[model samples]
Target: MPRPKSPRTRPTWRRRFALALKIFVGLGVLALIGLVIAVYVARAQLPSFDELKSSPNGQMIRVHAADGTVIVSLGPSYGEWLSFDQIPTVMRDAMVAVEDRRFRSHIGIDPIGLARSAKLAIERRGEGRRLQGASTITQQVARTIFLSNKYDVGRKAREAILALAMERKFSKDQILELYLNKVYFGGGAYGIDAASRRFFGHGAEALSLSEAAVVAGLVKAPSRYSPTADAEAAVGRAGVVIRLMQETGKITAAQAAAANPTGVALAPAPRQNSVRYFTDWALPQLETLIDETTRPLDVWTTLDLNMQRAADAAVRANAPKNAQGALVTIDRDGAIRAMVGGTDYVSSNYNRATQAVRQPGSAWKLFVYLAALEAGHKVEDKVVDAPITINGWSPRNASGANRGEMTLRTAFAYSVNTVAARLGQEVGFGTVADMARRFGITTPVDTRPAMVLGTSDVRLLDMTRAFASVANQGVAIIPYGITKVTAQGETIYAQAVDRSQVLVAPYVAQQMTDLLQTAVNTGTGRAAQIGRPVAGKTGTTSSNKDGWFVGFSSGLTTGVWMGRDDAKVVPGLQGGTAPARAFATFMKTAVANRPVEEFDTKVTLPEWALEPDEESYFGQPDNGVYVDADGNPIDQPAPPAEDSTDDGDRVAPPAPVPQSEQNPEQLDQDWIDRVLDRTPAPAPRPTPTPRPAAMSAPPRVPEQPSDRVLIRPQEARPTQ
Candidate 1:
């Protein structure tokens, strides 16, 4: 009877058990829902690897200029990726030997490597060596693409799981390909091909066995082994790789010993984030050429590799021994052809061409005078070079000496610092600033009297672009590197020349061009003379902090800048010296095979206005025929009243001065005295001056001849 009673069911206990079962079922359903949601989210977040791989878009690439002369690159590129099939067997074998000894046999998991790594770690732990890591190639690739480098037990567990999953989904070869393409091998490069190029200056296929071993070693610790990071250590470590390859039987001992004694030459140059002058000129134009939001883009730019090399060489070839330099070139269509950011792109990536915002010094006079021309002031206008202040800022000439009253043309030609200051003020600071910006000046401009004297800081690229606008006859086509973009062979973008507006009057451009021509012919820019009709302007920063030569031929425009990376000024270097000379040398060689073209017909001046007085402002002057704004001849009825005044009192006959000496106006007698100091004791030839006359004939407009405009110097005579 007692046993029967004990067998009675315990309803409370049964109720608790049933409730626990219900709770488990509900929790399982909730977990299933959460997992479905997570799967969807993860899928949505992941980009299609196939699409990314197949597309050759959303990338910047090198292209040719009109003359087929330069190489220009832009953006954090995923371009020109070399395929696995294209890679050399030697390189692949080296990678396998150095990174994964059993890459082909273990289906990417490499169990044998794992066992060996565990044993080593255990053995080290026994001896307190603290060694670690057993990652295979597949694990490394997964970590690179989908995980961070942060170390932790949980992270290691996850990496192993993902690697196993990846092995299940992809073949060993596919995993290797992904790994090869996704890894960063230092030098701002991501992928074996780019790494190959960055480290060896050639394609992966061209790498030697030693080079391959070096690259393989980098896979373990890229930054530590980067030649730029530490050249001596990197090269030294390469020897270890060669030895390891031999020990592993991947390479014979003889082969290892026979490898290049130099090891891998991964010393291309330190990649720099400093401004790139040429790229600065070229990028804005590319923005207009593609629609990046909708799809990937591949831009085929206009770049001439040879010209780029030449420009770089010219800048570096003649740079001050203690200074660095930059050079940029663009075609007539506003396409960037070639760009060298610095004298040594490898040693320094600081691209002065785009980013060096130093004072333009006297080189800024070009814009000051151009603005004057646009403001209805003739190049022959006259202004006082005395100690006058503009907005409380007094500017001095380059020579720190000023000349009295002189024609604007002469002031500009001489680069009279004081005269330029006055003209800049007269042109209206706001107007000049706007004009300069419109013409492509990128740095912040100081709207003070000193601006006329080039007190405004500007990058080499901006200086070059502004000059390009002037050379393009006032139609500013912002320099563009990329010409067109495509996606999966589908044309997506095509860049056409888009000149927003005329920066200045066409006549003003021609006049400015003519004025620059005179500089190349006889003034400071004399060293920049070319066989063809070329035009450009030169600049020297204060204390010679920066030197520049920006010029353009009919089909191309180029600029060169030289200076120190740390803003250390060079001694005694002027825009007209090495900078101009380099420009001239490059231009001469570049145009040797091309026909010489003249600037569009020169503007005929009405003979009423004085000869271009721009020179007086910059302490320089031009000697063109005197004319008026109306292009008419001067009708003044004044003959040289013979004996009216002796040569001594002959108004001191406005003397010649350097562009740097036209400021802080000095007594006409003092200026003449200085000129005399520079001149020979007794000159057989007398300088000619235009006399006041009432000529009835209309100003003679040189016919638009089809001959090359010669740049020879002879009393400022016209080649036409």
Candidate 2:
């Protein structure tokens, strides 16, 4: 009752309360001023007007063929510029409806829209619903042109301030034009004009309602909404845009229902040229050519368009779905004229021609045969084509039948496994490996007997280059792709003139070429023969996993391989079938206009090896013969058992009998067979004297004078 009677009695407290309220209000006003000042200062540090106007148009690479024709364009391709009035009204309405429904009535910022968006975001979070964004058209223009796309409070504050500045400087139409002109629309398109041309192949002014909706939907995620990248996603996004347009009254419900995403027309994508394989190979070379640059690059290459077309057609027609074919054509000077890496580059960009490391199979016999010739083995030397095993592994002939007592030339033509293996042991394995490396084969070689039959893995590129050496008359040549690269109309790099060194002796190369010619003419590679003289080899792996034909005309070296990426066997396919046919198809077109040339067949055998002597063969023809360092025929021995048939169809030789029961001649013959079989020679025992009943026994063979010799003659003694 006392307080109610005199409320005014607390005047001092009332005055103090009033003064505190005024001070609080003053601090709030000062804080607001500081915030405004901070926002303006941050805006000043953003991208300058000149920097925004001079943004880089993405880099482009233009690859040209050897004939100076533009084969293809790589990288982002931007179209002509578009103006605000040139943009279709439907496109504008579509963007406005999807991006900002209240775009026309709002200022640079919309507090009500922000509040509504925030409330919905909170409700969605609690209800597990998708959130909605509240960026205005002005704000998007500001961010795309002058701000980073970060989403923290500082970025939001700066975005708001810059949007206000943009609104104050330009009208709504100008802000919209800026946004439409600078926003990305996927496939490296940066503006509405480029997007329209890339997607519709027309100007922006010609966009239809459905097309406009598609363009509008791409604003969310250009790559995801790009029709080329994902047509289904793009169509779904366009339907969403159409629904939003209907809800916003930009289009009637009937119109929205009538706009079918499937009915939307899109331009055909540009044809992807097979030459991309060459560009992929040549792109890395650009870094070495130009250290670094922002300018457009023009690369001049050695690719012949006609040859590329021929190679592509050949592979497409010949290669199976599960299998792929790779073809590389290199000139004698080492310039790559054509290269087809795979069947379809779009489906798979793997470059089989350059990157696949496959077992060369018998194609690798080129190196083996070359090594033998260099080590003093003649093409006409005799070798038995009987079944033979080395170190517990017996390699069977592909034909499943062996020819008996054939010359080395016949053995090579038939791809005889036993003869090749026997020859590998005669010529040191180390020598074969060295010869392969000397010819530019970087693959590691194992000296095991299986390696001689082509177990080592080698890249098709390396093999092609090695064969190019044979075509170049023993000069080793390194394959090259790009000729030169220019940047901004100035030459940045030019390839150096190729310098080749002799790796194989001319005589040896000629002999090898002769061997290969026989292979193509009458051997397993008969399918690879062209109208012009061709010399090459055919190779098939153990399980038919890889089929290959690597051959050369006098002017070009071409290699073709057919196989699965997973190393699975192609059913019933062999090197003489798909691979050889593809090579012939490509080469026939490849050398149409070139002059016909033959391989240089001149070769001279060492004087001592020119003729065969009585010592070359044993008394019987069924036994194997021997050759010395100078390729002279050394000696041969008769079969172990007197009943042993002269035919080469005999089984594995019986193990050596005990020396004590045999005459000196039988002991000598047994030791010689062990050496030929690569079995360890028996330990020396006291010589046995023959009885008068076995006077046919010959002189005892002596030990090899040097370990390097595969066979050495016995020392002669004067007869009593």
Candidate 3:
């Protein structure tokens, strides 16, 4: 076998070169065939030219204030559809320089740029950096319109194919226009005009060089480079863009120096982004009111920008540190004028005004009192404030001391828990719950005696609506924000004129208003007083967890709530302290120019309520006389020893006397006769003394000088 070795021969250089060339050619041919197959697949999947060109831009919802001031734009906001000529030259040049310097010279994809990006990517890979992108503007347009942004090889191949197709079908100007109009800028902005408006409060045609640079810089990282998000970062990015513009000869060195981003003025968006809360609340209603939201629609909201500004200022200034606050303002017609969901929308977007459900505390008493009035109980009707136990649950006043007896008005104004509990029990908690539902409290109201003290939770908006019902003279109100929705200057939907539905009688509303007015005048809501007849109530939850003030004046209703987000106690918090003061602060400016209007003064009183009864006489105990259901003291023997047990710490409830036995009409006649000296009147009860210190009226708030004034204290109210 060894002897059979073949002769060794080396091929000439030409033969070896030919063999290498053949192998290279075969590989090239195979690559070309694979590329052809991929292109065919991608092309087959491509949309028609018309379909791609006519693709809709992002759905923009321009929310405007009642005065037509743009508050916010929800979804992906698009500005006016602009042609290439309408776009500013500086903006176009900046985009080209920063995004793709070879955009005009490239045929869909730039080989030079791709090779450079690959080199950089390879260099950065060792440093664990993100890969560089070399997508031309044409590629970006194609990706934005026809292909997904996934970073897979297949997606990139499709993107390249689409970009090539777009280049062939459209002019360079058209491609640029599409890119400028469809690019996603941070802050929910799409299109050059939208980005310009969002960042500079003007159209793209009005963008200055610096502003244009800022917009163009957002192409790399919209959120991180957004001027609204971080001005310094945006300015630095813009400086880079300016440098690129100068190097690309789109701008001169002097122009680049002059295009200082530091001097750029951004649009006047709220620093806290407070208006976003309102827009979030309103945007959902658009679907119900209109057929679809696929187009750019103009929403004429009921929000008053001035009021919104004031509300934001007040909440930010007054909300306690480490605590949150919410405020909502509505006109008499139920139009929500201002809403601050939390102290700052940036920190947390949980809408406390419309979404949070917390105990309303004594504010829930509004429904109980309204129920009593509807049940023929008068504000001046006497009710006992003695210690009471319903189902083993003992409710105590905020003061923790029982005020023996007082008029219904005084009890309500003072927020006497014992009196409210007794009234709820007598009037029936079912009726109280129904009354709350009538006033638009959508939250579940427990039909239990404890609910009379506001153990059930409710939203600030629901409580505000309940008060608005009373302010509307018993008419139920549905809070609304959108007044009209239009598209392309044609009205798509208008808020229909809803017929007013009376939830309570006019007289009942009037009577409830009187009680509320007294509460503001001297009771727990005194801090909420605005000089020209305001009516409202205050609510404080257990351990001072939640404080609330809901009031209405001058055809406007406003609600304020302060609390911790975790339902934990904010030590020393109270309804009249921070919440009431905030209400007054917001309302002072809220109703500054509105004409002073007084609540309806005509309230019909019950016959028995005309004369003062023992309980109504300065909240003093009765003179050993057992009162019947009519509150008229009857001549009866003293209660038995067992009835007076427990060391007299708890007063025995009045013995239930038959209503037929005590004729209220006859008693009224007898009172009239006694006044006329026709019959001997019972010896008048000894003049009752002033209320106890714990139950005494609050000190009068000093009067301010104006037709419509808020008597704000020089210093903030003490907590609790």
Candidate 4:
């Protein structure tokens, strides 16, 4: 009986063992089936070899100046596609040692490395640490070419399957070529070829062992290990790669030791062109002309590199220590030839020339004078420059003093603030704003006493365009930089040559030009005189926060602004100092060898049009709309209603009609009577009562020539 019991225990043990074996076999079978299904699915998702080869890779976009010189290159570009033979043995070995130690031995996926990594990853998960990646070079290529960068296990499985499939589809050399080309190096380069040329200024095959090691190290972290960006970090990374090469038997110990050079010979950084601002300004235009996924286009711009350099030098030499400077030069045809957005773009790239909006100060007087001229005011018209107030807001001269009455031209040349305010009021703020818009100043203009003094914030580029209209003899110029765009050698876009409309009457513009010339000759902008005929104005804000000199030569119009970004006052900074000197320095070089040309001195208005009138230029309507400070409409008493007749005939009043309600015929008769002495013009009607009060604070005093303390002439001129 005892023997029978012992035999039954052995059978029980065998039965238990059999059950465990069956469970293990079933799980094994299921895992095999799952792996086969995953492989099949991944295989179907993989892109075809030909399709992968032909996919759009990053390409270069070249920007050229007007003279066909390459100013800069912009791109997400692959330098030059290279075959396996084109890659040097040293570079290939360095990349293999650093990126994938068992690249050649593994069939795309390294099972040993993956298992070890998984073991460590499992342990790290328990410790709550990040898992390390164990992807081979082939797996990286597969992930780059055919898979999205997903981090889940399912994606890893797919990546492994695709990598295995790639191994079967292409030779090791082919896979290596693709890997080299697909990896990203720094500075917008995408491949070894581009990276080599970008960092070393040479082709991949020309890379030395040390250079190759540095280039290979960049594959791990392009920006961190860029030879051009971080020389120390790049050399340190190269040392690691060199050590790995020695450990992998790719190079002898002596060779590895010899390769440890003190420094890497990175290419010298390209000189920053003066037209960098132009490219930056044109980039948005380029984006609009071509789609994001479209091939790179050649952007031909109207940049004159020589002039750009000159402008850049002038800005750097003239800008104050605490201030930044901007300069822009436009041709007579509205072509932007040169633009220096800041003294040093590398230090700050805010593009002050095109992007910053600051008070124009006295430079804005141009529009006020033009508006007055358009309203039948002659340059010689007398304007009282005594202290003036509107709605309890008094505007004073910069010195807090004023000249008695002065001619409009003389007042303008001296930058008389009270007279400009008076002129703005006589012509109407709306009329001044309209004149600004017509001259291509698109920024919002506040209709205030100070607006005539340029209290409104306006872009430097817009101001340059506005002055260009005066230089161009009233033709409206829309400033532009891009000239043409080509893709695949086909013209995709070209700046259409549109005829500019007449913004100001030629005669009015001529008169304004003459006044500006007077300003440069002996007034506030005398610092801007360049020997040749020139016209310009100087502007300095109340606190000396903004200084400007905007002017034009016969061949070019240029504007310069000097200011601190934070709007802090720069001591001794005035438009006549730094900005005017910059304009003179830049214009001297810009107009070299060109004959000095004079402005057309002819005034376009008729003799009668030169006489002042009571009504505003655009005519005050009967709807009671008047502009307040800030350009908002203010309700004013409408002109007294005239008696209406139903007989379709109008009667001329015998008594002298009131100025506000007089018809055109009555005004003409009154003017003719005054001119011919037939009847003495009725004593001028009293100025209408002030409009509704709107201003909350006093108007700031505007800069004036008399107020300016001419320090030393050397203070105005910057050292070269």
Score each candidate by Cα lDDT.
0.61, 0.71, 0.75, 0.74
lDDT of 2 by residue, 1-720 (tens): 454746666689788999999999999899778766755665565455445434546666778899987676666644444567888888888999988888888877887789988899887796865434778988988787767887677888778888866665567877787778777788877667778878998878888898898989999999888988888999999999999988888889899888987787789887766788887887787876677456567889999999999999998887755888899999987889999999999899899998888877778888888888888877887778776666665654533345578777777775667677777777877787888898888877777767776777888888988998988888888888888888757888887755558887888888888888877765557677787788888776644567788999858999998888887545534566667778889999999999998678732211111001111111111112232221123464323322111111111222455867544433254454455353333543322222233222233333222211111122111000
Q: Quote the lDDT for 416 in model 4.
A: 65
Q: Of models 2 and 3, which has the larger TM-score?
A: 3
Q: Which pairs in model 3 have colliding backbones?
A: none
**Local accuracy of candidate 1 as per-residue lDDT tens digits, 130-241:** 3254788878876777788898887776676667666665667677777776677766666777777777777667778877767777877888987667766666667777
* Candidate 3 per-residue lDDT over residues 396-496, each given as its tens digit: 54334464657888787666777887889989999999999888888988885678877777999989988988998998888999999997688999986
Clashing pairs in 2: none
Best by lDDT: 3
lDDT of 4 by residue, 594-618 (tens): 7889787621212222112212111
Each candidate structure's TM-score, on Cα atoms with residue i matched to residue i, is 0.59, 0.63, 0.69, 0.70
What's the lDDT for candidate 2? 0.71
How far does residue 523 in candidate 2 sit from its true spot (Å)? 3.5
Superposed by TM-score, candidate 3 places the C-alpha of residue 75 at a distance from the truth, in angstroms, of 3.9
